[model samples]
Target: MKTKRIILSALRSLGKNKLRSFLMMIGIIIGIIALTLIVSVGFGAKKQVMERVNKFGAESIMIRAGGGVQISQMSANQGTTTLKLADAEFLENIIPEIKGVAPFSSKGNTDIKYFEKSATVGLLGCTPSYAPVWDWNVTAGEFITDEDMKLLNRVCLIGTTVQKELFGDSYPIGEQIRIDNIQFEVKGILEPKGTSPGGGDMDNRVMIPLSTFMRRVANIDYLSAVKVLLHNPKEINTTAEKINQILRERHSLAEGEPDDFTLITPTEATEMAEKVSGTFNLFLALLAGLSLITGGFVIANIMTISVNERKKEIGLRKAVGASSKKIVLQFLFEALAITISGGVIGIVLGGAGAVILGIVMQIPVSVSWASILTGVISASIIGIVAGIQPAKKAARLNPIEALK
Candidate 1:
């Protein structure tokens, strides 16, 4: 009952100076808002990456032409020609876990035309194993064959987006499309893959035999990447290490020399996501920490001033038999009330901010229970730490001198 009275007394004091109480809480509100945003964006972005990795194939690994570069290896945007089809074949022949290998090269934004209509799309040159390796079979007609790749045939497979853009509802299996002024017969329509992890449209490209792509289109003898489908996912790390050693020996790189090729597995994809999000989140955390510290100092200073100004009130309460312990609790409760209110407000706004960011950035964003719990705990801790000195000061005043 006495504790309830002290809490009520603290509320009443805050109500008398609403503006000052809000000022004390503003810093906490901002800090909690930033903290929640970091968690929401970080988790949501990581979820997006993991989802793509799952879709890409849990048992798959990719070897890109470049070691490391600014552009992502997933997008098939690497310009290096260090990786080759022979390297892919060599790995498959020796590695026991390898089920299939599909060496491929791609060129983004390739211009193609169908009669009067034309569109720009990704152009992929892949071997016959591409279908089984990717688990992505054509929905209609037939996929490329060894004969087509061997003869450097101009046969092609079109994705749904390309079909919709150039062919529209018309029967497209036997239709011809021109890529780089070279007409190719459409053998099949690829199943739609929707959006990629990096936000590119996966179903907006054309696939042809790698031989045709190298000799006729790009005029390159190198591969952009090699996709290896493993029989056992549990032994992936060992398999990847074996692949690395083989590639180094083939390339004739000395010890300690950087690898020309880069390996990307499901685990590496997740780590890539963590590194990206971790770096940005680290910066945000510092900002949030600074705001909380500033808010703590604000609370401490405002509260200390409030203690000095409320001398008459303290004196009257002590005269009326309010104990020193109750005096300490009352002031402490006031600070707690302000911070708790700020935290609630911050959480509500933070969730809304996350939604706004999702729409604006066109990426996933989610608020978790963990973020809310963190906000509540952070606010409470700041209030207790900031309130101690002021509460003790209010409690130690001489009743006679204070009343004067």
Candidate 2:
């Protein structure tokens, strides 16, 4: 009953000083907002990283032609001739860990036309191993066969986007289309994969046999990149290092000289992407920390003023036999009540902020109990830390002196 009175008295005091109560809670509200952003951003970043790693293939590695250049930094035309089909052949034969290798080249925005409809799309040159190496298969017809590679047949596989653009609701199988002035027959329809690691539409490309692409289309002997799959993903890094060493020896570069190729593993790509997002999250964490600290100070200052203003009230209550512990409890309760209320409001506003952020950045953001709990805990900690000194001050007051 005594504790209940203290709480009621605390609520009455807050009700009488509405503006001062709001002033104390403002800092907590802002701090909770920052904390909410941290949790939501964390959720979004993790999901995106997983999706990117899955798309890149966890059990595979890519050997891009350009040396010393990061996969994300390499341009379309930076193809180096040092990494050849021979290097791929050697890697296949020498590396026991490697399951398969698919050497391919690519060009973007190549025009493809059917009867009257036309669409420009990204083009890829792929071998038969491209299917199993990537675990990507056709939805309707067959992938590039060994016969297509041997004969350099002008045959192609169209992605769902291309199929929709050209064939529409009609069947795409056996449809003949012109890929940049060369007539190619569509042999298959690719599964509708959503987007690439680079954020391009994965369903917006055409796949042709590597031989045909190199000879009939572009007349290039060098491959743009090679995708390698592993029988055991646990050996990916070791295999990558082994392939790197052999390629260095085969290319005949000096002991210290860099090899004319870059090997990108799924783990490395995931780490790279996380580094970018992690740095951003770190910055937000700092801001949240700073805001909470500022909130604590704001709360403490207001609580001190509240203590001073209620000195006479405290003295009267003490004279009426209220204990010092009761005074402390009342002050603490007031601080906690305001903070809890502010935390709730901040969470709602922050969740809306996260949704807006997701729309603007084109990333997925989720609000869960984790976000709510984070906001509540953050606000509560600030409230307690800020309430302590003022609560102590109120408890230690000399009733007679305070009454004066």
Candidate 3:
């Protein structure tokens, strides 16, 4: 009952100086807002990155020709030319966990023409198994076949972007298009794949037979990369190691020599994204923590000033038989009231701001209840820490000295 009275008295005292109370809460409000936004944005970015990584199929692996540091499966190679169709075939035969392999070569920014329209687009040469390996779908007609590869047929599949640029809405299947001055029939239209993880257009290319690419477009015997699909995604690391060993033996590399090719799995890609997101989140958390600490100092200063201003009140309460503990509790409750109120408001405002920012910036933002709870709890802790010294000072004041 005495505690209840102390709390009520604290509330009444705070109510008498609403502006000062609100000012004291400003730091806490800003800190909680920063913390909440950081958490929500970090979660959303991580989720988006994972989704993008998974789009390449979690059960798949990619082998690109070259050595040195490689961040993603899509990383292009220039130094090594050892990776070939034979290497892909050998790995598939040796690794029982391998489901399928699609060896492909690419020519970048080649001028392709149909009728009077022309566009510079990427030219990919892939085998019949490429569709199944990448889980790609043909919107119209059929993908590359063994017969086309065997005959080195001039049949190609155009992506939606190419189709739109060349044929517009008109059916492109069976239509003849000229790529690098070589005429080829459009056998199929690729389904839209939107954008790559690197923000490049996925559906802005053309795919032809691997044999045709080797003989005509790129004029290279070596493959650019090999897409490998695994029966079990969990065995990605083991399978990748096996593939590395096989490739090393085929290339006849001696002990301690750096690999001539790079192998990347979906798991690796996801881990990279996770690491990047974690770093970003840590940086954001540190900044927010600094803001919170600054806010704590503000609260502490305000509470100290309040203690000085209410010296007479403290003396009056002590003269009326109120215990020093009651005075301490009263000041602590007042600080908590200010911080808690600010935290609540900050949470609402922060969540709303995150959503608006996400929408405006076209970035993903997901607010969780855990983040909200953390903000409120952090505010409460800051309040307690900030009020402690002032509370103690107020409690220790002599009644006569305070009254004087």
The local distance difference test score of each candidate is 0.90, 0.88, 0.88
lDDT of 2 by residue, 31-52 (tens): 8888898889888878877887
| Every model: Cα RMSD to truth | 2.5, 1.7, 2.8
Steric collisions counted per model: 0, 0, 0
Residue-by-residue lDDT tens digits, candidate 3, 1-404: 28889889989999999999989888889889999998899878877787777777889888888886465445356456888889999888989999999998887778999979999998889999988888887989999999999999999999999988999889999999999999999999998998776556789989999999999777788988898999999988899899989899999999999998888777777788788888988998998889888888888898899899999999988998989898899989988998898899889888998999899998879899977998999999998998899999999999999999
TM-score of each: 0.90, 0.95, 0.88
TM-score of 1: 0.90
Best by lDDT: 1
Candidate rank order under TM-score: 2, 1, 3
Please list the residue runs of candidate 1 whose C-alpha ends up more than 4 Å from where it truly belongs after superposition: 69-71, 75-82, 150-152, 169-171, 197-199, 253-258
Clashing pairs in 1: none
Between prediction 1 and prediction 3, the one with superior TM-score is 1
